[model samples]
Target: MKGLMVKDLRLLFSQKKTWLMYIMLCLMMSFSMQGAFIVGYTVMLAGVIGISTISYDQADNGMPFLLTLPTDRKGYVREKYLLCLLMEACGAAVGIILCEVTSLVKNGSGVPADDIRSAVVVIPVMLILVSFMAPINLKYGAEKARLVMMIAYGIIGAITASAVVLMQDIMPDLGHSALVKIKVFFDETLGGTYFWTVPVVLTVLSLAVMYVSYRISVRIVSNKEY
Candidate 1:
């Protein structure tokens, strides 16, 4: 398993697509520091980076070659999922660093430690999305999986837009009362007492998703005749 993982990492790093992604991530991080665009740029860059890693296998017909080695099919599937998790973690770390540096440069002071907490929330959600998508790719291959993902993205965007519109319409009547209630809820329920739980819960969920994805990928790959 360790040997196969090392080989997969080697292949991942050696690919030009991987480095291209890294460069693009760095550029996005630089722009994201501008404060006008915070979450959008970071989330988009992370998504592209995750999808590009999955595409690497399809582009090179890597599976048949991978099967030529002594490793089991299950190991290959597991390695892919693990690699995605690592990539997401790395991307999140890079984003955090870039955000801090950008805040310092623009504001003449670092980003508040509290606001940094909000930015980190996206990392786990990104992992969950990637975890869910990995098995889809492993079972469906790149072309079909890309279509599925595109549709999913569209649905999420539409939902978000609708929710924003509804909120804008409702906000006039709710006025300061709604804002006060939200503040009180956050202060009472979501304050420092439960802040640490977000990452803990997300980590646990990501692990569960990773495990299920591994099993499903193994089943799909095992049935294939290489």
Candidate 2:
């Protein structure tokens, strides 16, 4: 598995695509995008980076050629998931750093620490999304994966916008009210260390999603001809 991971990472870094992404990410330093948006965008790009390896593998009958080695289908799937995790983590970290760097450059001050810290939650969100994407990519190859990701990204964006609009209508001050509610619920109602447990719960739930995604990917790959 280590060898498989190393191979994927080597292939990932070897591509000019990876550096092209880095250059694009760095260019965001002048944009006014906040930490959360930056984090989400980076995580998405990272997952796509991992998926690009699949395309490369498919180009010359690479999947069959890879299995010709000592690895099995399960190991290959596991390595892909691991690769996704690693790359997404890197992407999120880079996003956070870029957000801070950009904020410093523009305002001479850092971003809201709360917003920056909350970016960790986006990591799990991206992981789950990537996990969901993996099976489709594995089954269909790179071109379809690109198409699917584009569609998914659009759907998610639309849903997010609609949700924001709905919330604003539901309560004009929903944002402030929700913050107050959270403060009361966590700080006052739960108190002590329980407030921090929300993140733990979210992490566990995200892991569940990732696990299900892994199982689905395994099934998809196992049934594949290659």
Best by TM-score: 2
Q: Summarize candidate 1's per-residue lDDT along 117-163 as a digit string, tens digits.
A: 66666766776777668777777778899898899899999999997
Given candidate 1, what's the lDDT at residue 161? Answer: 91
Q: List TM-score per model, in order.
A: 0.74, 0.75
RMSD of each: 4.2, 4.2
- Counted clashes in each candidate structure: 0, 0
**Residue pairs with backbone overlap in model 1:** none
How much is 139 displaced in model 1, in angstroms?
A: 1.4
